[model samples]
Target: MLLANLMAFMLFGFDKRRAVRGMARIRERTLLLWALAGGGGGAPGAFAARRLFRHKTRKRPFVRWLWLIAAAQALVLAGWAMI
Candidate 1:
């Protein structure tokens, strides 16, 4: 989980920096994959990344997908807790 969040954090920061430089961008799909891989519980790493970098917060589709991933992670956590 720690590694997943760290990966998301770095990737998001790198993407934001590239955007500022008008350089090539990381794909949205890749970013979301890291978020989904945020491992087992709580909010996806992208949430922290967004807060820290102000990245993608204004993109409606991306935000929606992030939330969806969070919901799925939360569900998994809940199921685990039930055991």
Candidate 2:
């Protein structure tokens, strides 16, 4: 899980930088893999990158919802870990 989150963090940061160059594809397969691998952190990380960099603002609603979902998933995982 930690490894997955790390990968997501790297990818999210990369995607943000790439977005500045007007590149914003989801890399669907990789995203799905990350999400499935317990890297729910990716969504929020992506959202934050977008917001902080002032990119993808048009997708704000979608990204905001995704971030919320990611947060919920992270909480669930944390709870699971505690148990």
Candidate 3:
């Protein structure tokens, strides 16, 4: 989880930099996949950076899906804990 978060954070930061330079952007699905694979903590930081950088803020799908993914992960964890 720690390693995944670090990777996700770097990916987000890198994506933000790329956006500023008008370079090819990272795919939203890639970011979501990282978050789903235990990088939820870093995912929020990515979204924050996107907002701060004025990148992808208008994309409703990314924001909505990430929120859903986080919520689903939380519910799954809670369910597991209750077992």
Residue ranges of candidate 1 with Cα displaced over 4 Å = 41-43
Highest TM-score, which number? 1
Per residue, candidate 3 scores C-alpha lDDT tens digits across 1-83 of 66556666667778879888999988988877776676234555555556666666777988888778778777777887899
Q: Which candidate comes out best when scored by lDDT?
A: 1
TM-score (all chains, Cα) for each model:
0.91, 0.49, 0.76
Query: Which of 2 and 3 is the better model by TM-score?
Result: 3
**Model 3 bad stretches (over 4 Å):** 39-55
Candidate 2 lDDT, 1-83, residue by residue in tens: 56665565566567667766887655745643453455444554444445565554676655565556677787877987999
What tens-digit string does per-residue lDDT give for candidate 1 at 22-56? 99999998998888774562245678878989999
Candidate 1 lDDT score relative to the true structure = 0.83
How would you order the candidates by lDDT, starting with the best?
Answer: 1, 3, 2
Q: In model 1, what are the clashing residue pairs, if there are any?
A: none
Candidate 2 wrongly placed segments (more than 4 Å): 28-36, 39-58, 78-83
